[model samples]
Structure formats: C-alpha cells, structure tokens
Target chain A: MKNFVWLLAVSVSLSGCQHPSLAYITNQGDSTVSVIDAAQQTVTHTITVGKAPVGVAVSKELQRIYISNVEGQSISVIDSQTLAVTETLSIQGSPVGVALSPNSQTLYVADWYSDRILAIDTSNTKIQREVIVDKAPAGLVVSPDNKTLYVAARDSNQIVAIDTQSLTIQKRIDVGVHPFGVSLSADGKHLYSVNVYDNSISMIDLKDVEAKTHSIKVGEHPYCAMPNSDNTKLYVSNTQDDTVSVIDLNTRKLISTIKVGMTPEGLDYDARNHQVLVANWGTNDVSVIDARTDKVISTIKTGNQSRAFGQFVMQ
Target chain B: MKKLLTIIALAALSFNAAAHGPSPQKVEKTIVIKAAPAKVWAVVKDFGNMHAWHPAIASTKLEKKGDETFRTLTLKDGGTIYEKLRTADDADMKLRYEIVDGVAPVADYNAFMQVTAGPGAGESTVTWVGRFYRTYKLNPPIPAGQDDETAVKFVTGVYDSGLANMKKVIENSK
Candidate 1:
C-alpha cells in the first residue's frame, strides 16, 4: 500500500513538470501557424491563419498570440490555450512586423507599404492610433519599461524610436543599408539592427544616442537578430548565406557561424529550453539550436515558407 | 501596327500583375539517371566542368581568389553568370552555391544540388533547387524582364533543361 502511494505521487510530480511551452511559427506559403511544443520538440497543432502570415507575437498575460498577415492585410489573434485563431483584425496597409506592450494591453504592427505603425488595443481589437514613420518600416520591438518602441525602417535605413505614451517619434537614428530586423538588449542599454544589403549589424548604444554607430560585419543578407536572456550573446540569421552568426556582446565580434536550413529569416530565443528557433523559408522547417553549445540540435518540419519574424515563444 | 501595340500592352499588364512583392520564390527540378549515386555526384560536384554535362553552358572558367573559389559560366546564348562555391559535402553528396553576378532575371540567387540513391539498384536521382527574388526587389512599377514570372520562368527553364540533359548524358555514358 505504501509503494502504491509512492508511485502515485511520482506520477503526479511527472505530470506537473511536463507543462508544455509553445513556439508559434508563421508559415507564409501555406497561410498557417504551427504550434510546436518546446518541451517535446514536436508540432502540437497547425492553425490556419490569413494569407502570407509573416510576423508573430505572443501575449503571456492574456494567453493570446497575434499573427500579422501581409497579403491578407490583417492580424490573426490566436488563443494560446485553445490553439485556434479567435479573432482576425483587418488593418489598412500591409502588416508585416508585430509586437505587444509590456502589459499586453496594446499591440504594435508595422505596415510596410503604408510606412506607418498601427497601435491596436488588445481588449477591443481596434486601432488605437497610427504613427507615420520612414519608408518601408519592417521590424519593431517594445522597450522593457514599456516607454520606448524601436522601428527598423528598411527603405530609409534608420531606426526610429517613438514615445509610447505620446504616440510620437522620439528619435531617428541612422543605421546601415536596408535594415530589416531590430532587437534590444535585456537591460535596454543596446540596440542592434540587421542590415540586409550592407551585410552588417548596426549596434546602437542607447545611452549615447548621438555617438557614431558601430557596425559589425556579418554574413550576407542578414534578416533578424535575437539576444539571449543574459545579453551576453546575440544570434543573427543570415538569409542569403544560410547560416546564423553568433556575436559576442562583450567583444562585439562574430564568434561563430553555424550552418542552418535554407533562407533562414526569423529567429527567437526560447528561454525555458535554452534554444534558438530559426524559421527557414526555403526549406520549410524550424532549426532549433542549442544555445549553450551554439549548434543545431534538431530540425522540426513545418508548413511551407516558415517565417516567424517576431517574438513567438511563450514561456 | 495596331496588333503589335496590343500585344505589347498585354505583356506589360501581365508583368504588372505578377510583381506582387519581394517574396522569395523557389524552383525545384529532379531527374533520375541509370547511374550510381557516386557516379552522378562526380559530375555534379565538378565545379569547373559544368559545360560537359549541361548543354546550355558553352564554357566554364574556374578561378581562385584568396581562399574562395569562383566559376564563370558562359551560356550558349551569350550570357554569362558568375558563381561562388559555398559548400561541397562529399559525405552528404550535396553542394551549395550562390550567384554573385548573373544574367538571369533574379537577385540573391542561392541553390543546392544533391545526389541520392534511387529506388532500384545502380540508379541515382539528382535534385536541383534554388531560392531567389525578382531583380526588382521593391513593389510595383516593375520593369519588364525583371518581374517574378520572368525570374521563375528563367530559373525553371535552366533547371529543367540542365537536369534533363544531365540524365541523358549519364545514361548514354553507361
């Protein structure tokens, strides 16, 4: 009787530890979002989204995921628990990049064609405001304090910072040519932009906004960058080279280039699993790399043209 | 003169319709040959002898600068393409290359070619796949011959003809 009770206790503990975290990947070719269970490393569900879904963001507080569909000109709000798209919000321009506020109350989307950033109220699913920026705004990230938002204007080759409360442009910092993705450090002390045409990364020191930009050369046509939780390392995905360039934040130099799937575009760091999930557009799969070792440990196949451009993993 | 003008207008309209965005397009072509995987890989991995297998390639010149290797291929139609070798893995029987400068109606072209074992014994399959975007990497008012359709058609024609001719040559050699 005691052995049976102990066995029951073990089973309950195992079940409690198995709570799954999901990585939402947006497949552009087939218009679907693949929900991957990070613990099990398998695709748990495939939810149909709008046409050409490119960007994805998750709200942990609300238990929801927002996907921006470029061709459909809408955003698909997915319920994280149900694994279904609960609402589809139609916006005006071509929506590509997406981000959520710190409190998960407001969602920011970058419209590429219209050159504007649309702020949507998450509660009502309506456009709260629009801030017009430079041409071809692509990637966006919200500050940790929820005060500043950085926008990567691809055509203008500059990073624009906006005041979240005032809904106005705060600063326009010049970067490399054709910057596509922008990321902030954990402490919000640094900003990095992946320059597509220049094949480099512009590292902007937030404290010294007026100083000259520091450019770190990388592989060809880098698309996006994601810093680790500790801000010690930065991983940038080079699309044309099919490799991930790992940069050491202390030295600000490329430490290694790990080969991954073809046309690797979007990248996100899974803090719970200590792995970086890379969306390979050409190969239609997600390459998960072991962050500790900086090696590709496994490749999970997804729908065609997997491009999860924004914050996708929900811990 | 009226009929010619009408044809030109239709062509322009078709080009405009296909220039949707700067989305990456893919082209894949596969062919089976009556040869072993090793034999097929020998031909595919030879970075300098593409003219021997591909009928469209008139000549190939290989050059080495620093630690990088490059090949300049002269097409039969008088067009030239410059490519750089990225990776060649003998164990995987796979090679990857990228077009540095080319006459094709595509930009940022990268390709992978692999040789694998076929269903039957002494048979092999060669697959060539490429991902690229149209030369006009921006939205609309796209110039002629640089639209998405033109890039797709040009790449597809290149892969199809090359793979078909490769099958013929390998089978004939055996």
Candidate 2:
C-alpha cells in the first residue's frame, strides 16, 4: 500500500512540472526587464538591459530573448534559464520594435530614426541585410507565411510590406496618421494596424489591397495590437486612454475594454495559461489577464515602466 | 576751403556721435513701414505698438518704471507673457528684454532680440540670436522606451518655427 502511494505522489509531481510558463517583460521607464513566472503569476527576477528597453522578441527554439533599447541603440540577449543578458547586439538608429522569424533563425529590427530595417542572423549576431523603408518606421511584423514583412511608417502614414527573400519593399499601402504598430492573421490573409493619431485599427485584406475594409474605433490613442493564440481575438493597448480594448475577430467589433495603468503600450498572450500580458509604460507594471474570462487576474510589478514582453525557451 | 572742410568735419563728428550709442541687446523686426527709420523707431521703441507688427502676438503693453527700464506684457493664446526691458537705447537703435517667469506655455525658454543698423558696408547689422531649452513629459511612457532625441525634436520644431516667422517679418520689410 505504501509503494502504491509513492507512485501516485510521483505522478502528481511530474504532472505539476510539465507546465512551466516564463516570460521576459521589458520596461523602458526603469531600464530593466522583468522575468515573470507566468504559472505563479509573479515576477521571479528582473534583468538590467540597455537604456530604455522598449521592444522584446523571444526565440523559443533558441531559448533566447532579445530586448531592443531605444536609447542604447542595441539589442540585449537574455538566456532563458539564467535570466541574464548573455550578449548585446549593436543596431542602427533608435531601434523601437523587434521581431524573430517564424523559423527563429533571423531577427528583424525597425530603426525609427534612421528609416531602415535591419535583418540580423540570430546564430552569428551579425546583420545580414539592411533594407531602407518609409519615413519613421516604428512597428514591424513578419507575415505568418514568413514570405513578407510589414512595417508601419509613422511620419509617412503608410505601411510598407517587404518581400522577405529579396529584402525589397513589395508594396506601400496608405494607413492613417502615425501608424505605429501592426500584426498579421494566422492564415496570413489579413493585416491589422494601430493608427496612433486616428485612434483606430485598420483591417486590411492582404489579397485585395484596394478593398474597403473596416476601421474599428478604439481608445484615445491605440498604439499596438496583438492576436490571440487561436487568432480569434485582438487585444489593443491604448496609450493615452490607459486601457486595453479586446476585439472579437469573428464579429470585427470591440467586445470589452479593461482599464490598466497610466499608459499601456505593449501586449502579448501566453498560450499555456490562456492569459494576456500587458506592459504599462506609465505605471511600470504588467497586468496578466485570464483569457477565458477577459479579466485581469493579477498585476505583476516589473521595471520602473515595463513596456514589452517576449518568450524564452527553457533549455 | 580749409575752414569749410573743418566745419564739415565737426558736423560729421556730431552726426557720428548722434547716430551711434551703447545698449545691452537690440530688438529689430523689419516690417515695411513706407515710413522712415525715425518713424519706425518710434513704433518699435514703444513696446506697446508691437501688436501692429508681430502677427503671432495679439497685443503688448509697455509700462515704464524708469527712463531705461520697462515691463512689457505680450498677450497670445488667451494668456499673457511678461518680459522686462532692462535697457532701451534709441540712439543705438537697440531694445533689450528678458522673458519673465511663466511668460509662455513653453516652460523653459529665454529669448533676446536686437535691432542694429542693416548692412551698408560700413553700416551696422541687426543681429538676432535666441537660445533656450524645452522639456517634454512622455504622456504614456514609451513602450520601446523614451528617446531623448524624440524630446529634442519636439522642442526644436517650436523654436525653429518662431525663428522662421521672425525672419519672414524682417525680410518682408521695405
């Protein structure tokens, strides 16, 4: 009977260890990145990164996290297990947004001031190509198909789509004033843009560039948009209004709005826990929401002002 | 002929002493007056008459405390910007003033305007130089973070526009 109890105990322990969700949130106000224990819903550790780290991208396959420093002009690489900066990759003028390829082998950096997109090889940490884009490219995304990259040009009021293979601009579609953040659907058929000045999200049909799609009204200043794991819901961080607007993809309408800290800017979803992590720039905190209910489950304290989050694989 | 030359030399010396004088800073905006320098100087020296020249400033009031010092209030955007003129030299064709605290929406700024004689080879040159710094508060803290260059751009644009307008006013003058 004792032997049977031991086996049952061992099985329970192993099942508990099966799910370990971790995330690294970059806070620009405090110049640090908070290492979060997603399962525990708390900040396990904080790592010091470059000055004003604003953008972060995780390569799950490589078990690395890349944080973009707006003032430092470099990317800090953090090891998932250690939660320490393992390497610093130098980039061009004021790197605002960063993304990893679907294959997790390449990194794309959008330089806001220099008006260029830098493609860096993750293994060598060397720039493979630097493609010039429209004026003030602030937000970037790689299509789910991994064949094209979309960049939002703030000053030009347009989105520049580039062919990933040729590193050439494929098309320039007119967005709204101060187009800052962009995202693509899982099927790679639709593109969503957060127009800062217009305070709305522009849904574009990639197949039909001239299609008159819907413009959903959002907060006072919609800065960035993130799609759910299932690609069914869209979460937008409204900077000026200090709220996050949850949109239902099927209805193409705002389902709910949740109030956050001073200025909520960056957003991403945790597939394992079904929670959304929001980086609030003004208050320097991250709000974790239960995706099942669309309600904030807990508030995790990060750097002085945590701005963005990325995943890091456990080696 | 020598006596006539001596009289002319004396007259020129007196004219030179009358034209040139000393001052701290010069304030000169070249607005085509269709009027003479003395007439324009009459309009420029009295800070109260600035509303007629500067388009951005709706009105101004000059209250003199002493022979050389005066308090000037410029009204714009439903508010008043106060400045103190430390020195006003009509002979030197100069007006010197310093912005008072809480004078404008711009929190940190110090400006000076000078009006000297224009280029005539030997003529004086009216030079205007302003130096000030502006600070910005990120309403929603930057997610990818605060770029100091971004703040610098915001302030630089304001100063640049003001300088451009001042230049336009002076250049369009007759």
Candidate 3:
C-alpha cells in the first residue's frame, strides 16, 4: 500500500550504514552530532545532543557514544546501533573532555572550570568517585589495560598519571607550556602530549622512566594528536594552520603536513578504512585523509563548529 | 583601589585571551566585490594595513618581536585591539589572524579572511569568518557586556561594516 512505501522510505533514510567505521562530530554551535559514514563519505545522521557538546567517547562493546555537553553541564549518551540519544545525565560541573576505560566500565568526565575528573559507573549509572587535578584539565586518556589514566592539567603545564584502581595521583610529569591533549600508543609504551601554546608535541616514553621527553615542533595551535594502528605514525591537527602534522614515531621528526579544512580540532584514525578523519571546526565539515598517501580523499559536510575533541570514532 | 583591580583583571583577560571555553560563537560574512581575487587578496595580505579598508580602524601600528608579526589597531570610536598574524597564504588567497586582546567584548578570537573566485563572472567573493568566546569565562550570573550576545554583536558589526567598506574601496581603485 502507499502507507507501507512511505514507512519504508523513512526507515532507510533514518538508518546509518552498518559498516564498523563512522565519525561522530560534535558540533558545539548547533548542539548536535553529525554521524559521518566513513565508507560512503557522507553524513547519514544528525543526532541532537545537549548544548555545547565538546568531547566524545565511544564504547565498542556496549555500542554507545558519550558526549560531554559543557554549557548543558551534562553527558548525552547515544546508542550507536540506533543512532539516537538514549539518555542525558546531569553533572555537577561543566563537562568538557570525556574518555572511557578499556573495559568500558568507567566513564571519565573532565570538569574544565572546577578542575576535577569524575568517574561515572556505566553499569549502575552512579557517581563512582572523583579525583581533583590542577587548573584546567583539558584531555583524558586511559591505558590499554585500564590500569592508568592520564590527565592533561593544561593550566599546570603538566601531565598527571592517576591509578585507575585507587583513583589517586601516581605520577606528575612536567611538560612544555599548555599541554592540552594527550595520546597513548596501543602498546602502552609511549605517550604524546599536544602543547597548544608552544606549538609542539612532547613524546614521553613509559618504557624508560629516565628517558627525557623529546619535543617535536608542529604547526600553529595544534589541538589533538592521534596515533596509527601499529603506533608507527602520529597525526596532529593544527587548528589554525588547517593541516595535520604527521610525525614519524621512530625518528621523532615531522614527516609531512596534510592540508585539511579550516580549524581542524580533532583527529581520529579509522583502522578499518586506513584513513584519518579530522573534525574541521571552522568549516563545519569532516576531512577524510587516506593514510597511505597522506592526502585528503574527501570532505563530508557536518554541523556547525565540528569539535570532536576526544575519541569520536566508534571503537 | 578599584581602578588597580580593574586593570589587573583586564591584564589577566588579555593574557588568557587565546584560551577558549566550551561555548565559542562564530560570525561569517561575505560580500561580492566588483574586482578580481588578486586585487582583493592584496589588500587582505597586508597584515599590518587593516585601516586601509576598514572604516572603523583609524590607524594601524605594526611591530615585530622575535620572528612573529603583531599589529595594533586604534579604533575610531575608542579603545585599541592587538592581534597576531597566524599566516598569510597567498597561494590560497587567505589570511588568518587572532585577537590577543582588545576593546571588543570577546576572548579567544580567531578569524580567516578568504578571497575566492566568484559565483558570477569577473566578480570576487570575500568572506570573513570569526570564532570567539564571551569575555566571561566562569559559570555566569551573566555580567553586563560580557555575555554571548554582546560578543557576537560586536564581531558581527565589525564584519558587516568592514566588508562594505572593502567593496567600495576596491571597486573605486584602479
């Protein structure tokens, strides 16, 4: 009948690509997330989230996406399968950066103004605990084994390591000026911090504690750094330069700079496609980079001010 | 004294002017000029010469410290604004800059001025896109002249006035 045909058309348009690769771009200006189908290179779904969503964390097992809404002061949890917001959990303070444990049991929300990280239990949806950090904690990353959580205390100019079990500070390593984003390798042997003010990246070796951190200069106002699958290369999004600085992890040297859209804020490496998805904040689009050639393959249109600050690609 | 405290607060605001909050507002304005892309880019490429086309900027002072480029703009209405040049890409016909601090009720302002070939023949399009946050950083009881509306209005006004003057200045010239 005519009614059945209309219903079928609506479902097809509403559903996303079933492929494992998709980019959730957090548009703070519009309070929405544009889910880009990486394989098709198009925005398939635009889910409404809380106001001023800045960060994202994806859970592969649970098929969920968590977004930190700074102005809304809450977390918007989206079910990946359905591509819909399942819940909006309120936080006591403003939430900026969000990350999930390797096991997806704990979700860490960084409070930008309050200078603290609150750990929320995903199972029962309880405030499990919290840890106080220094001024302006901007980025969060958990180890592969979920034993350590690293905090980029941006205002303090240092990276603090907290024990995941006890939620206590274990080590505080000083880095260059204004370290905003931190990335850990898959093997958990190396860590990298993006220094927004210094325009460089600090490479820290966890294998050798005595190994002094090496600073590699990058482009202007680099915000996020993401590593490849094998941990051989690192790609950093220079917000002002509209380019990505690709650094060879072995030599600690800048290999090449890949030009992207305006104000590229977040970098996510898609393993299945062997591509890097960059969220362009100024242009409201996502630039797809072919990792092998280091060239922009395609640009998918997103919502206004796309700022997927954390891990946006579903695990 | 209250005066000293106000000065201290202003200094602190300028120092952290590049640090943004979760809520950043953006304004984008574009105008079709009766000129070529090359002619428009030339005026925009001169990072220190903003007063040439902008009617509100009375004069501009250029300075260099170390390897960086900086400029000071004296506004006609009042107050001065300081800016740092991020890049001047001639190949792309683009110029980028950020406001360190200024009279505007904005913080962490970054902008790009791009000149592109037109939607029509023999016409150039100039777009000014700016991203900035309100001067107030903390959770607000919302002070006067420091909210999102004030910051957006100031930038929108600047872009509108400047683009209109730029079209007139470029079209009238040889």
Candidate 4:
C-alpha cells in the first residue's frame, strides 16, 4: 500500500501545475514552435506558427506563450493548458521580439523593420498603444516591476528605455555595433545588452544617476544574453561559434562554455528545473543544459533555424 | 488550299519562336564600386586590382589592348568570369562592360554601374542594374531531368545578401 501511495505521489507531482515548465522554441526557417518538456529532456510538441517566427515570451500568471513571426508580422498566443494557439495578434511591419507584462495582461512587441513598439492587451487581443523608438528595434524585455521596458536598437547601436506607465522614452544608452538582445536584472538594477558585431555583452548600472557601463567578452557574434532566475549567472548565445558562454555575474568572468548546435541564438534559464534552454538556429535543435554543472544534458530536435525560446509558470 | 495551310503553319511557328526564345543559358551577379572619378578612373581602368571592391571576383589579370579597353579574366566562381572592359567614363564615373565568356548561371546578361552626383553637391548616387533571363532545363550529361530555375534562385539569394552587405559599407561611410 505504501509503495502504491509513493508512486501516486510522484506521478501527481510530475503532472502538477508547479512542475518544472516547458520551453517553447520558435524556429524561423521551419515555421514551427517546438515545446520542450523540461523533466523529460525531450520535445513533446511542435506547434505551427506564422512564417519565420523569431522571438518568444511566456506569461506565468496567464499560463500562455507568445511568438512573434517576423515575416508574418503577427503574434501567435498559445495557451499553456491546451498547448494550442488561442489567438493571433496582427501588428505593423515585421515583429521580431516579444515581452509580456509581469501580470500577464499585456504584451510588448518590437517591430524590427518598422522601428516601432506595439503594446497588446492579451485578454482582448487588441492594440493598446504603439510606441515609436530607435531604428530597427529587435530585442525586448519588460521590467520585473512592470515599470520600464527595454529595447535593443539594431541599426542605431543603442538601448532604449521607456516608462511603461507614461509610454515615453526615459533614456537611450549607447551600446556596441548591432545590439541585438537586451535583458534587465531581476531586481531591475542592471541592464545587459548583447552586441552582435562587437561580440560582447555590456552591463549597465541602472540604479545610479550616472549609469556605469561594463563589458565582458564572449564568443564570436554574441547574439543574446539572459540572466538566471537568481540573477547570478548569465547565459549568452554565440551564433557564429555555436556555443553558450556561461558568465559568473558576481565574478564578472566567463566560467564555462557549452557546445550546442550550429549558430545558436536565443536562450533562457528555467529557474524551477535549473536548466538552460538554448535555441540552435542552424541545426534546428533545442539543447537543455544542467545549470549546476554547465553541461548539456539533452538535445531535442526542434526545426530548421530555431531562433528563440522562453518559459513561464502556469497560474 | 494546301498553299494557304502551309503559310498559316509557318506563321504559327514564327509566333512561337518569338514568344519563347531559347532558354537563358546562365545567370550571374556582379558588383561595381564608385571611387573619386579621376582617382577611381585609373584604378578601375586596370584589371589587376579587381578584387578590391567586387564581391565575387577574388582577383583579376589584365591583358590590355590599349589605354581605353582591356581583356580581363575575373577570378570568380573558380575562375570562370571573363569579361572585356569596353568603356571607362571619367566624367560620369561609370563602367560599361560585357560578359565575353564565363560559366555564370545566366546567359546573355549585360550589366553596368553608373555613379552620378547626388542631390547634394558633394555626395554621389551609385546606380547598379542588371538584366538577364533564366531557363529551366536538364543537363545533357544527366539525361535532361534537372531543373535550372533552382540554380537561378540560389544565385539570386547570394546576390541579394551581397548587395545588402555592400550597401551597408557604402552608406555607412558616406
């Protein structure tokens, strides 16, 4: 009786809502988003999206995922419970990056070709606001506090910060050549910007009146950088070298580099599972690495030219 | 009645030939850069340094017939592009040339690049244009099953990326 009870408990935990979440990878070339089961270390589902999906974001409170299709100029919203596209939001120009509010009610999309930021109300699937920013904006992230939004300007080589409430540009900081991905620390104290051409990640102190900028070297053509849940480690995707360089934030040094697939792009660290999910653009696979050991535990084939991946909790 | 029917058949064959000419033999992509007219004139006039700005040509060898024209073999696509520099314009900053012989994908292609002063007095507008036709056919050795349109599309993608890269360099500098 005890043995049966123990098995029941384990199976219940595995299917629990608090169970380690799945990561959705957007494959640009294949027009599909792959869902990776963190516990199994394998792909459980591949959902079809619009053509050339580039960026992905997930909502913890709403239990939903958003994918931005660059060529289709739309966002496909997937419900976590059903794992189906619940809605599609059409926006102007080529939507490249997407971010969801902490409350999961709002989504911010960056239009790369149009140089604009679109605010979408998730519940209604309607455009709330259209904010214009620097030229060729790509990467996007909403603050933990849901106060400020950060965007990477690809052609302008700068990072634009906007106040979410006012929907106004608060500041613009100069970065390296072709800044692609931008992320803010969990506490919203530091802003990290990845410059693709310069192959470096710039760390900016946002708390101080005079922002102090520091840079750490990474692999060739560094494309994206994201912080761990604890904000202690940063996983950076090196597109040309096809590796993920793990950086120790406290020591400000590269501790290790894990080989992934051909030309890796987007990356996110799953806090619950302690696994780093990497999107390999060239080989069309998603690699999950054990965050504790910095080693690849498994690789799940996604699709050709997989670009971005994200994870969130189900409310 | 027989004579009239024969005349109609001849007319139909002529119309068919006019509508569908022989499939284009090959397709190719070429680039041209604009330098200061007088200064760029002499440099581009020589076939020796063709690799400097042109994307595909790795190198070049010149067999000069005179000061105005030269027979050149461009090291592009495994040393297959051969063209004759027919005219070099000093005032207009233009290069007009013809594909004399080559293994480029598109056949019967003529291209040119003309650099003219922009709206602003100091700046210049470089216009690059090419006209070519493509045909889909099988290789003789392969028993005529291969389609050539796929090859044309592949070359087009390469040229598109190359042009984007070239424009980035040129516009960023100016």
Q: Which stretches of candidate 2 lie over 4 Å from their true place?
A: A1-19, A309-315, B1-174
Clashing pairs in 3: none
TM-score of chain B of each: 0.86, 0.48, 0.88, 0.54
* Candidate number achieving the greatest TM-score relative to the actual structure: 3
- For model 4, the stretches where C-alpha displacement exceeds 4 angstroms are A1-18, A209-211, A309-315, B1-152, B155-174
List ranges where model 3 is wrong by over 4 Å: A1-19, B1-19
Model 4, range B1-174, lDDT digits (tens) per residue?
A: 232222222221111111111122223344444433344344444445555545655567766665645455443435445666646667666665655555444343444455554435444445444433332221122221122343345345434544445544554554
Alpha-carbon interface RMSD for all candidates, in angstroms? 5.3, 19.7, 2.4, 17.7
Q: Model 2, residue A267: displacement in angstroms? A: 0.5
TM-score of each: 0.80, 0.63, 0.90, 0.65
Could you give candidate 2's per-residue lDDT for residues A1-315 as a string of tens digits?
999999999997786568477777887656788878887978888889987787878875677889898767789998876777899987656777788888987799887667889998888876578899977777788887789989898778889999999899989998877788888777888888899878899888898878766789898668788778788899899875669999998899999999887567778777788888888765668888888898888988777766683323221
Candidate 2, overall lDDT? 0.67
- Candidate order by lDDT, decreasing, is 3, 1, 4, 2
Q: After superposition, how far is residue A150 of candidate 2 from its true place, in Å?
A: 1.0
> Model 4: what is its DockQ?
0.03
* Candidate 1: residue B153 lDDT (0-100): 76
Residue-level lDDT of model 3, residues B25-120, one tens digit each, is 889999999898898899988988999998778799998989899999987655688999888889989988889876667788899999999978
lDDT of 1 at A84: 79
Worst 10 residues of 4 chain B by lDDT: B12-21
Better of 1 and 4 by DockQ: 1
Candidate 2 CAPRI assessment class: incorrect
